[model samples]
Target: MENTRNVLDFFQKIVKEEPDVSAAVAAIRTLMNILENFGDGETLRGLSEELRKATEEMKKAECSITSVQSGCELFQRFITLTSLEQSNFKDCKEIMKKRGEIFLRKLQEARPKIARLGAPFILDGHKILTHSKSRVVLQTLVEAAVISKKRFHVFITESHPDLSGVAMRDELLKHSIGSTLILDSAMGYVMESVDLVLVGAEGVVESGGIINKIGTYTMALCAKEMHKPFYVLAESFKFVRLYPLNQRDLPQELKFSSTIIESNHSNLLDQHPQVDYTPPGYLTLLFTDLGILTPSAVSDELIKLYL
Candidate 1:
């Protein structure tokens, strides 16, 4: 139950500074750290059950899609470690520790590669529109400006309900990149002149679609209408096997609240979903750690990973 609580709390706590992949990596690290502190055989067995419970809890919640996928990966890693040469208790602990170290190292390596691989898309003299918040997207833009020495303007929508895009805008400016902040409603109005649309994903499904902040799908539609090249910058780890056919198939959390709306009605916020699904058709390409891939190529990559 305690591990269950930790998993529940982790899923509920949204760290704005970290994107879905970052948060997931942090969660797995935390879990591994906790296990490392208690290395006895009985404790390991107990932790195994607790970790499984935690993974199931994540599955049941409105977790970031990367959290769901990473949680599963961490559990599988634990299982693999347990299956290793268990001739000695100390050796088993060593294996688990080494596995954790390797996982962390891989996660660290993927982030920068994602930035460098996607930064090329941010050419000079182009206006890029992005919504919500994505650390990877910010890093990509910053890399283009600082490392690549390319000058570009970034237009960010003030992602509503939380206004995370304002943070993105500020971060871009801090990196000495040109940026502008606009309201969520101004996506169409602001995107008319945008040469490219670079967005980040909470999860990239096997079907090549992406799950992101609520306004992303709309922004993607607007970008498509404007004939702008819309790109998604995602680490390969954020890709999930789940394929949602439409927004309705998404597990959207709705809270009934009228506090934000100065209205006579009380249930105005009842149907507000924090995230939505953007179809693959709206996407121009997915710049991933594997390579720049068309939306339809997502399933092929997943198959390759599994094989």
Candidate 2:
């Protein structure tokens, strides 16, 4: 229980100190810290169990668990792979720590690579529409403007319940990028004006679909109907092994924020869902560190990693 509290505090502290850092990265870093300080002579199974408990604690502390869940899953996979190569438990722990550091370094390098890949698509005078706040998306915009010197306007949805889009708009304006903040309901009204839709994912599921901010699916539907291309900017680590046929197909814990899940309210209708699944069909392409991949390619990547 104490370790779990420490995990939660460290996770929250990282988020508070670095507002741009994704929860997934913070979760990974927190786990790495646990790996470093984990007591000597503990069995690999014991360490894995401890890590699982810490992950659950962090999940309960956050409004959205997609990133935390995915990060833990990937980290656990690293442990599994390391254990296969080493017989000594201590050697396996050391190897995992070294590999974990490398993995984190790669993740840090991913955004810049993705920015370069995504920048070409931001042509001069293109009117881009983005939902919510994504560090990768923001960096790509900055890359297009600062590095490529492309002139463009951005329309951001006022991602409600959190108003994260407001923050995104402010950040873009800080970079001297022209932007307009619109209501979530106004996506359709702005669809004709938007040349393309760019969004960030909390989790890119196996079916090439995405689990993201609640309104992403609606925005994708709007883009599809308007015949506008919808692009997603996400890192490779954001991918998860899950297939959701629809919203209801999502796991219960993945649907609501910690607050909603812990709420005493007997009626679920009173609570708003934290995230939604956007099917692969609605996505034109995914801008990832791996490359520009069509939706179908996501499963191929997952197969190589998991299978």
Candidate 3:
């Protein structure tokens, strides 16, 4: 029973500490695997109940994290819950999928607010630029496109190393959406023509600032210089409570495989290329499941529910 509590605590920590979706998904899968292989029937039942509680906790945490209205206290409450083990792979997968779907539904609920912010449309076929591939952003854009009828042309940065943009570009093409793929360096040149900028956040801070893929900060800076509006399309669950007090003093860690580093043979090789942080000032508003929020207002709004 004590071991089960330890496992549960660890599960909650992974959900809280890991900012990356891939990391979170991987952690959840690991937990599910452990439960599936080792959990007894009683443990499985407990885990299912715990998962439901986690889902509820996640909803509250989302409000806190995205709105920047509160601290990490509420999320910490859920972290104290006990964990359960599972005995069946099928059951574990089903539970994870169900939880994921619930999370996605929460994201969908924010669509109306996202649409409202991008309102009055850019009539002259506004050029919107973004980097990295984001499923949430894609869904939001697709919905907007359907409503605006090709009133916007999207420019995507060919996210290097992973080149995830290619897949994104393909997906857009399938929808007959007009889009342009640009090299990361070309962002400045493209910024001049862009009317607005939109990107996805990997994690949002309590202050309403955001951490995203590398090059996002550069894009935001460029947008700031150009006096263009920059919006972040993200769900509340992506908000992470912990933050480095001194942003510049934070350790720079590698985000990708060591193989890429070992093969370079030169010290100048790319070491870290996964994500970057853009300060709150660079963003205009946060389009979240709850509503649109400004940097200063997010925390107050979040605090209403979770504090």
Candidate 4:
């Protein structure tokens, strides 16, 4: 249990220190730490089990673990691939540590690559509508304003419960980009004013749809009704093997926070869902490190990585 607490502490420290880092990437870094500190007596299987247990413990903590699951799973796969055909256990461990560093470097590069690809979409005088606070979305807007020298306005939702969108608005202001914070219920009202919708995802499912902060679907629906384009900015590492036909299809762990799930509240209606699914049909295009991809193209990329 002490080790579990240590693992959770490490994960939380990474998040607290680097607010821009995604929870998924923090989880990956924590797992990498486990590999780096592995003892010489530990077997390969034991190390894998340790990483698996750390992931489960993280999910139980009072935080969002939606993308963490996918990140940890992909990192585990990379470790397995690195472990193949190694006679000496010590040599295999060393190889995994080296390869893990490379994997992490690639992930760090994904955000800038995605930002560059997404920045061009924010043309001068264009108004972008984004929900919640996405590091990728934030980086893209910064890139457009700082690098591309484009002048654009942004409409951000006052994402409820956390009101993370307000922080997004403030961050934009820091970059000298004009932005407005509107109520969550005002998505339809603001739809006509914005030229396009851009959002960051917690996970990009197999259906090419996205699981993101709550109210993302509402924004997408409004964008669809108004004939405005809806774009998603996400890293390819966030692609999870989920195919949800509707909101109910999402797992409880993904929808609710760890605290809410553990509670035995008599009125279940009081429990708020942290995330929602936006179907592929509503999305215009996805800006990823892999390049601009249609909704249908997400599955192709997922197949390449997962299959």
Model 1 spans with C-alpha error above 4 angstroms: 1-3, 6-21, 43-46, 56-90, 252-269
Name the runs in model 3 displaced over 4 angstroms.
1-124, 245-270, 301-306
Candidate 4 TM-score, true structure as reference: 0.96
Report, for every candidate in turn, its global Cα lDDT versus the true structure.
0.74, 0.89, 0.60, 0.89
Off by over 4 Å in 2: none
User: Where does candidate 4 have its weakest 10-residue lDDT segment?
Assistant: 261-270
TM-score of 2: 0.97
lDDT of 1 by residue, 207-272 (tens): 999988888999999988989999999877677767889877764321212232334255544557
Clashes of 3: 5
Best of the two (3, 4) by TM-score: 4
| TM per prediction | 0.83, 0.97, 0.64, 0.96
Count of clashes, each model: 0, 0, 5, 0
Error of 4 at 141 (Å): 0.6
The residue-by-residue lDDT of candidate 2 on 1-307, one tens digit each, is 3568888999899988998788888988988989888876888878888889888888876645887888788877865775557877788888888888988998899899999999999999999999999899999999999889999999999999899999999999999999999999999999998899999999999999999999999999999999999999998888887899999999878888666766734657777888999999999999999899999999999777664
